[model samples]
Target chain A: MSAADAIAVAGVTKVFGSGNGQVAAVDDITVSIRKNEFFTLLGPSGCGKTTLLRLIAGFEFPTSGAIWLDGADVSDTPPFRRPINTVFQNYALFPHMTVEENIGFGLKMLNRPKAEIAERVAAMLKLVRMEALAGRRTNQISGGQQQRVALARALAPAPKVLLLDEPLSALDYKLRKEMQIELKRLQAETGITFIFVTHDQEEALTMSDRIAVMAAGRILQVGSPREVYDAPADRFVAGFIGESNLLPGTVERVSGGLASVTLSVGGRIEAVAPDGFSGGGPATVVLRPEHARLMPAAGAPEGAIAGTLATAVYFGTDTHYHVRLADGSDFTVREQNRPSVEARFHAGDAVAAVVEPRAARLLRERP
Target chain B: MARPFDVRRQRGFTVVAAFCFALLYLPIVVLVTYAFNAGESIANWEGVSLRWFVAAAGNAQVIDASIRSLQIATAAALIATTAATLAALATTRTAPYRGQAATFAALNLPLMVPEIVTAVALLIVFARIKMATGYTGLGYLIAAHTAFCIPFAYLPIRARLDGMDLNLERAAADLYATPVRAFRHVTLPLLWPGILAGFMLAFVISLDDVVITEFVKSGGQETLPTYMLGQLRRVITPEMNAISTAFLALSIVVVTVFFLVSRKRD
Candidate 1:
């Protein structure tokens, strides 16, 4: 690892209960995060992403393995002594304290001088644009303001790593989007590592430098948003990262990096296999919705699968056509709504679905 | 807070509520008003005077008893409230423990049992201790009071503890505070009002207790209530009524203050 590696977890495991009741909440997992990176854990609820974050934060102890922060083993350290902070899901502002006081509590715990605490709190409040509401009781503020206060309080302490557990999940749509950009800007300004947890894939893709996509208490893939979206490693990741049509199939032929597979439904398709898939075997092909082209029967080309448009959804920027192919496979294609005749597609019309061979991914079928 | 004139139903409710209030307050009101009676008779109406108040003030035994009661009740409330706070914290904050309900029921056993039973059980235990070490300390009364008052203090505090948001403490820990620091800074401040109310309730309960105090107290260790009870056996005096009236007023004041404090928090 380089000097820029801020947090490293190796073979971490967490089990709840004992003996007959034992259930593993987090299976053995390993990850490394670089300094000043806004990394996100993207998974559905109950996927152990939050558990992994808590283990890193020292809020929950790992049942096995080690966690390192800034090259020091901090697995056994308590939360307070660790150079990490978190913004809780509910924003957890101290109801008894004013906004200024709530933001100043961590500094107070450091036993900083009163004047210094005041100065730092003032700067933090101004950064969050909450200086005007600093004197108000925390419960008296609006949810968005409280959210800012929670962020300000966490950031004011100058932690090396900040964990945000679904911080924007409680906010309304507009505020959540606004906070996402604000958080990105704040991370840019402070140059601190942020490990945010969320189930929203779009939010993760939009705000994070890298993302660890998790499911069933295990990490499925870790990569940049574009990398994960365009080149998912497995069916779970492909199905998760973006909308995709997965066609389970058996591998019939394999070349250097490409594979021609016979789908389960009696259709031959080509896919780009991940490295190290050697030969003939049962496999699955994944295709992104936008990768497939929908053309009317008159303009259709050879090698195109025939289908009828089941539904056409108009989404301002793009129109998605859901086509049910001859093999009974439902495929969706998103066409940009440019001012052209080709942009118009209607449900119940016969069309041809064409996807370039390289646009699809092939994965070995799981038991 | 006003009801725009409901003729019949409102009057009926008003009369019924007024009757209940009268039933609650009549004795105490009469006692306070006539505590200044100039005559010595207990049953006759007489002009008021400050004689009994003066007498009550000058009596060394009554003053000593009052001081002792205050000390014991304060100690008991402090001890009980502190223990109850810890119990509340463990049950609310930590990961759920097995048989938590059983633990809660056991802690709350004292409230369900009769006060006489607790008084006798304490007396027997104290007797054994005294026989073993020959110490007739008043510490036993404080201990008994603390044990009996635990349930009264625990219930309200535990309710507040349950209602308190755990997210605040998580936020504190996330902000790099140790668990103890989070409890001190975040949990305690949010829980203070409930703690105060619980303490005050335990204090009042300990002070007004007569049966338990009579059973556990040794000869010559007279609390104010016990002293008044002793007087009641021989002759009923308006002077006893005056002391009772004072105790009643104190209870009302503490309860009212508790309500105001909790309301202001809301």
Candidate 2:
């Protein structure tokens, strides 16, 4: 483990139940979270993201492997002894405690002096901008206020790391957006390593400095948000991060760091092959909908794949055209809504979907 | 104001409810009224007076029995509530084990069995034990009451624990509370209302229990309810009504206090 790594989870595996009913909740996994980085574990439900967070929080003891915090093996350390705190998904604020009391509880547990606790709690309340509601009980506050209180309480201890388990999932869209910025600001101000867990791709992309995309108790890929979204490691990661048009094909040629793959849809497209490509092996070309452009087939450039528009979906910011390619595979091309009325393509319009070679990624097919 | 339902339908429902209330409360009202009757005969009210109340208060046996009953109920409620709380925590908080269903069934057995059967079974066991050791005291009554009251106490405690979000306890631990501290600070405070409710329910059940107390108590260890039964078997008087009224009042006060306490500041 590096000196700057705040947490290092090495080969951790957690299995639940026994015999035929046994299931691995967290398979053998290793990841080093750096100090003061906004790292995220992103996956759908049952993908073990929450379980990994819980394991780090010391809520669950791993069946094997070690968890290192600040260069010390804290695998067996109880949650209270760890220099970490969690903001629960439901914002589990103590219903009986006022916002101030809730925020001060950790300091009290740490045996801090009453005066220091008060000052710290006041500072936290101010940080979350909840000073006015500090005296209100948890149940008396709104959902957003309660979320702020939860954050304040977890942050008041000034732990080395803060774990958030989809803390913004319960908030409305507007509130979630606001808190996303607020959380980023808080992370910067506190300079605490944050391990945020969320299934929301947008939230992860917006807030995290780096993200680990997990599925089925395994880490599929780990990279910065931009790297993971633009150059995913596998079909799962590619599909999970955002909307993508995966064109299945067999590798036709490889040169330098790029490969030409003969698309199953009767086209040959050049893409960046992350792993060196071999001839005659199945591969998939991942094209983000926004990267593919819809153009009239009559005047289309070379390397443009011909297709007939199947549907036109008008999203306020952009229009998406679902085009059926020659080989019966469908791909969607999104275009920003232009001010000109004549730029729109209708269903059944013959068009060529063109994607730049640099924008497409070639990945090996999963067995 | 206009009625939501037809007048006839409302009247019918009111009549049925009133009839049920009368069925439930009229006998108790009559008994209470006769406790203050000036006449010796409980059936005939000559005028209202506190003569029976005075007699009941002055009776040594009634007083002793009341004190004994209070002691038994308090002891039984404490033991039962503690045991029930532990049982609830184990069954609800822990992961499922092989015999979890059986354990639940065992806890509920006392409630499922007939009271008379339980009383007899306890009597036979106590009789054997007493013959072996010659130890007979209020302990037997307390033990029997505690056994019978566990299920009553367990249900509400379990429900409360189940209704509680486990996340709060996790949050407590994350906030630097140890397991024990988390239980003390988070679990216990949140569970107080259920525990208090369980205690009051157990206390009332033990206080009002007659069959179990009769079978379990040794000589001169009669609880108030068993003592009242003995008194009624021999002679029916306004004093009996007075004792019953006082017992009812005590139970109401306990329940009302519990209600108020649980409802406060939530």
Candidate 2 lDDT by residue in tens digits, A1-367: 9998999999999998889988898999999999999999999999999999999999999999999999999999999999999999999899878889999999988989999999999999999999888788899989989989999999999999999999998899999999999999999999999999999999999999999999999998899999999989898988988999998888878888788888887767889887655555787889999998888888988778899999998888898889998878789898888675654678888999888658988976666
Worst 10-residue lDDT window, candidate 1 chain A: A338-347
Q: What lDDT does the true structure give each of the candidates?
A: 0.86, 0.91
The C-alpha TM-scores of every prediction are: 0.91, 0.96
Residue pairs in steric clash, candidate 2? none
State the DockQ, from 0 to 1, for candidate 1: 0.63
The TM-score that candidate 2 achieves is 0.96
Q: In candidate 1, which residue ranges exceed 4 Å CA deviation?
A: A250-252, A262-268, A327-329, A338-346, A364-367, B1-19, B36-44, B47-51, B58-61, B257-266
Pairs that clash in candidate 1:
B36-B49
Docking class of 2: high
